[model samples]
Target: MKRSNRLVALTNYFLENPRLHKQLPYFVNRLETTKASVSEDMDIIDAVFRNEGLGYLQRTTGAGGGVKYIPEYLHEKSEAFIHEMCHQLADPVRILPGGYLYMSDLLGNPKTVREIGRVFASAFSQMEIDVVVTVATKGIPLAYSVASFLDVPVVIVRRDPKVTEGSSVSINYVSGSSRKIQTMVLPKRSLEEGANVCIIDDFMKAGGTITGMINLLEEFNAQVKAIGVLAEADDEEEERVVENYTSLIKISNVDLKAKSIEVHPGNFVEIGDRK
Candidate 1:
């Protein structure tokens, strides 16, 4: 095949099987071309991927050498998208009676959620994540979105035990905002032993829910690789339960009486800057 055709096919293959490594000889044989010609095609494809902020194509040397496609969303693009979300979240009309900003609209948007997933996936891409874990309801979409990009399955924790899920483990945790104890249930067989889990959530006040999920994972002997949230409520009085977590947007301040809300980029801004 022609070099142009080879480049297109190679690009598609990388996208279809991201985070996969393939030896140069495999490509050369598949394309029925010399190693030098295949290398030339890889160069063009790699350049396009990096220049377009698509991802990274890493080349390894030595006896067990190969090329790996690592998906990455450029920090600049992620920052811009997140800042735009902040503006949307800053709308005073979204402020509810309990100072909760209405985010159902944002969470329901497939396009928005997909982008947020990409941001989370990019943020935690360095980790060896095997499964995405989240609570039922609001967090399901976010969890699925991140899992899709990472090519992993999602494990959802439920408020009430379901008969359909079979045997399950339950744990009680304090609700940061409500200041009440609540039980969360997870299926016993949902996760495997030593599985690297990435926790994703929609909003966090004191991180009580995420904390509960962490405790529940203990039963399955899974490791928490990373944590990510779409937004985090900045409440000074309420101490955050989880220390190492990333959020896309920060709710700095909210006033129901004044109908005022303040939002800005979250910890990801600092993290993304370093990258």
Candidate 2:
């Protein structure tokens, strides 16, 4: 490959797989390029990315820290990339008999999960998302992944009380799917008044849990910067509550008999408008 093409590929690779970029010496040696040359190419790529309104790329200094890409790029290509992954996750074969899809693989896959997190973090790139919030269990990992990209702290909402934590403020919320009354608790010090909060979750059914989370934020007098979900099940009944939220993938249907699934892009097509 030509030098220019190689640089572009390297930069794009780093953007997609940041953890790999951190081991720069290894990559540099493998590519048979000097560290200085790689550094110069990275500078050029970073400039091009930012100039094109794609987003900014950052490199951290020191032994442990390394090059990282903070994507500001909101484009058709990125959206399509996320949409494709959502479709893959929507496979009907993955859907168990209970109409619930097995998404643990997608959620645990580091590359896929990180990409999904970056997609949402990009949406809040401009906003001051002081902290990321999510309910206990499944949402915790998603919340942590997004928080890592945003370089912000994560505040987990507990579904049940735990003995290790100190005093916590609790709220009663109805589950969107079950419509059963459930309690969510957060440490009083987890967030502060007037904090710019971003809420993230793995799935959304009724959005009642999100509503309760929003209420919890209100109790702290924090402003919800935005709400994002990895995947949303297109259930007509649960649609009412989550009408205002944004989802990366909209799973419209799962034809178990045919082993087919339907998916679509979310309303985030115009993420740049938020600026």
* Candidate achieving the largest lDDT: 1
Candidate 1 per-residue C-alpha lDDT over 34-128 given as tens digits, one digit per residue, 9 for 90 to 100? 88998888788889889988778889988989998887888888999998999898888898888898999999899999999888998888898
lDDT of each: 0.89, 0.76
Q: List the residue pairs that clash in candidate 2.
A: 54-73, 55-72
| lDDT (Cα, tens digit) per residue for candidate 2, span 1-275 | 44676686787686665332465686576567777777787788888878865666678778875676676545655677776886677556687764677888878788777777777777777686899999888888778777876778899999886778778899998887887999999887678888899999887777888999998888899888889987777777546575557677777667767677776765665544353
Off by over 4 Å in 2: 1-45, 48-54, 57-70, 255-260, 270-275
Q: What lDDT score is found at residue 3 in candidate 1? A: 87
Error of 1 at 4 (Å): 2.1
Cα displacement (Å) at residue 225, model 2: 0.9
> What TM-score, to 2 decimals, does candidate 2 have?
0.74
